[model samples]
Target: MLDLNYILSSDYYKKELERIDRDNSVEQGLYFIIQSLLRSTIEEKYWVTDISTRSKKHIGFSKSVPDLTILEDGKTLFNPIAVAEIKYFPWSKKEYLTNNERQVKSYLKQVDKVIYTNGIEWIFLYGKGGSLERKESICLGNDRNTPESYYECINKKKLLSQIHWKNESDFKVSWDDLICKLGAFLK
Candidate 1:
């Protein structure tokens, strides 16, 4: 389990999101946030990352680089297991879903399993053709559990028609039993 309040309340953790990004990308902020969280919580899996495999495709050849990869424990298994794709906070749900589906489909060619996330929305993908789909959806900011982060993104239509906006925070995550969830996932 992780200390959500302790970790999230820190200036260091908060600073990661405050930094400026190249080309004004919203996704850049989350790269830092996810990196910070992984560093603080799951160092064993992600820290000292296997940089050699960061963007390198599998043996045969592939065109995409997964946002993150958890190598298959070759000691126990002969092939790699999980690869992940990430989205940004500013993107609409539709954008994240469609883009991640495409990304996971591409990654599936090289690995057996794929994970999709937006730092908060974690969806596990598996199976083939007809069976290819999302499963094990984990929302770090669950609607009832963590409403502060259950945002639907900004409504551009309403912004033009009326000056109204939803009051939601960006990329905020808390322990909220995620320690148990992550423990199950990591295993």
Candidate 2:
């Protein structure tokens, strides 16, 4: 289980997320949060050796850059097993989700799995039939207006899973559940 008390109470976490909420670097800020969670060593099966935030290139013809990538064995330079992208969609969420999927597919063909999130929703994608398919999706927030971080969202309502396609559906996520979802993503 993850130590939610430490993360949610930290002033630094709130300040950093607020900064991300105001800027275009949503992916970087999300990466910072995830990296911090992994550094907490909450999981015994997997340990995040490296996580690149839009700096590492996906091994493909286009050499596209994903928003976030987690490397299991940090020995190789580009050994990325899982990739994630944090998108901010304040308008036309469906359109943004479609576009983000395209962005993930363009670069992350060889990666094992991918996570696409907007801090409020998390979409897990898997490559299938030469395309990226939505494996699962969950909404961890009810308020769509100001969902810039997990702290803001979870404090508001009940935490549920798999509320992505349902409109007006409110779901929440615990820190341990979030870590399990992202930690086992590579496998």
How displaced is residue 95 in candidate 2, in Å? 1.6
- Candidate 2 regions with alpha-carbon error over 4 angstroms: 1-27, 38-63, 89-91, 128-130, 146-176
How close is each model in CA RMSD to the real structure? 8.8, 8.3
Tens digits of per-residue lDDT, candidate 2, 43-144, equal 443444433433444333144566555555433436556666665534355576565555666645657577676665567788843376557765544324
**Pairs in clash, predicted candidate 2:** 159-172, 160-172
Q: Find the 10 residues in a row with the least total lDDT in model 2.
A: 162-171
Each candidate's clash count: 0, 2
Which candidate number maximizes TM-score? 2
